[model samples]
Target: MEQDPITLIISLAGGILSFLLLMRFALQLSQADYYNPISQSVVRLTQPIVGPLQRVLRPKGRFDFATLIVALAVKAIAILVLIKMSPMFASAGGSISPLHLLIFSLAGTLNTLLTIYFWATLGAVIISWIAPDSYHPAPQLLLQLSEPLFALARKVIPPIGGLDLSPILIFLLIQIVQGYLSALVVI
Candidate 1:
């Protein structure tokens, strides 16, 4: 948790961008309705960047491969910028390795995105319990985003008594995966 100005600026700005990009990436994957306010806003916020990247890195089905690249690129750039400004680099006579930073960025990006999905899935479960029929875009998006994960969990353990336990079960798995990815960053 470096609090230096450079680190702070990069982290704050980069984190917001990364989160937005991640949101856009998930929405793209879920085939969210663009007309929906939340989905439309995400698209508007990310279109300028991902739109151009899409030209070069065409999508596959409902997947926005371009959004993935842009999100990863944003994360890598943030990591590189932070590394360039770190006191460690100065102490090490500016010999920091780009490869190491790149690895960190990739791991961090994956971890963050997974964490987002974890929360989104939990939100979906909560929403399902509280208001399963809500027509809001954000809630609907969460359900859509969690569908694939829930399906996996359903495969392992089917719902009982009109209750879906996949969310709780899957949430634990997400935590395990997040920890694993974070450990990879250290390596």
Candidate 2:
């Protein structure tokens, strides 16, 4: 399996950027504290791409459509660039159609969202074991991100023995969704 080093580098860089961009999109969607160090850094890192996209795309209420679009674009462009850099990649799989590419990018974005939630849930669970304080930005953000899911779980499972089992249920649910998304068809 011969892999082009350049393509690997480019794809990894694009993936990281898209992940960060999607994080900003999620944070905004969840109404996270914008003044926090993480939120501010995400905004600054992605401002260059998202700033112009916002002018053209316009946002829909709290959701940043431009940021979402930018995240998808990053994935799409990375795949296209990889194909271009290594024509062998195309020959191995046949030509990738535009519609196929779009679906592929969207699936990737969905997978990324699932991944973000998985980490957020994990962090929130860990913090609850230590100190779940609102004064700290990271734990607050994790709690903010995971609370809705936890709420849903509580509605279904409820607490037991004065212990919050919402996190466990949330993890199970996240894993189920992750499995489904991973199996999602792009064709």
Candidate 3:
């Protein structure tokens, strides 16, 4: 039941990279200001791989499929490596079905993606209350990233008594979807 240092390192590195890639994908999807320092850092970190991938996999509309693909691949590789190193997996003969691995990776990717939005939505709500008109790149980026989800929730929830409940609704929906995705993983 003891954790390995190498496994921890791999997990941390993979998770950070995957999050950055997903951010790049979301920033493009949201049409976020590229000049933002955070956006610039994400693009700079991922450009090495995404730049080349873009040549073969051009973006569809506002969706950056290249960044998404890299994120998913990174998640999959991280999961695979961790599973191989897991004591439980070793005890079980270290054999995972390809289908199971695929499902796990996809579920992990989606879970992480939703997690990004979950925090973003929460951050936007807090920022709106704290500094509704702030021009800072971080706040602006959060608002841009979360507006789509809030819009969707607004359609269903709407404002009541001058209190917007979109963030609460979006939070509930994200949690529900994330739970369902987690259920899809067999291992």
Candidate 4:
């Protein structure tokens, strides 16, 4: 069945906001400097939502995965609520099972997270390529953000010719996973 336009729009907005919040939290947790005006503005805008989460889900050791978890939770909840309310507010011509809704929400969150990872990784690679000598903040931030994903990718696909093919492989893997998860929900 075709999705309601209003519901689809709301769901997309919620997913995007949640993803930005999560990415900002991740960037901060990585201790990347928000030196640029744009970066600082993002931090300021998202701080209200993320500050409480950071307090509640305080880091234990060196890493802080709480932001990521909280962000995913927020997106999942928002998507679930939108799905549940869609039937009441508008008709989509077909019924969506609760399990399907849950899976779809999960797939949405995963897709957002994977997209952020891909962009951040790509940004890092680009910065490294362009400014090998310059002391830029974006490159450093990107490297820090991409490290975890690249680490995981390295185990499965090693680098070739001093260039890391892990991010590309990881992006493909994420897309495949998202497709599989989406099929479980809506196909």
- What are the per-residue Cα lDDT tens digits for candidate 1 across 43-77? 89989989887888888888888887887888878
My TM-score estimates for the predictions, one after another, are 0.90, 0.86, 0.92, 0.68
Question: Which one is best on lDDT?
Answer: 3
lDDT of 3 by residue, 105-166 (tens): 78877888888999999999999899999999999999999998888889999999999999
- Deviation from native of the Cα of residue 156 in model 3, angstroms: 0.9
Name the regions of candidate 2 deviating beyond 4 angstroms.
Answer: 86-94, 183-187
The candidates, ranked best first by TM-score, are 3, 1, 2, 4
Q: Taking the candidates one at a time, how many backbone clashes does each contain?
A: 0, 0, 0, 0
RMSD of 4: 4.3
Question: CA lDDT of 158 in candidate 3?
Answer: 90
Clashing pairs in 1: none
Global lDDT of each candidate: 0.80, 0.82, 0.87, 0.69
Indicate the worst ten consecutive residues by lDDT in candidate 2. 178-187
Top of the candidates by TM-score: 3
What is the model-wide C-alpha lDDT for candidate 1? Answer: 0.80
- For each of the candidates, the C-alpha root-mean-square deviation to the true structure, in angstroms, is 2.2, 2.8, 1.9, 4.3
Q: How does model 4 score by TM-score?
A: 0.68
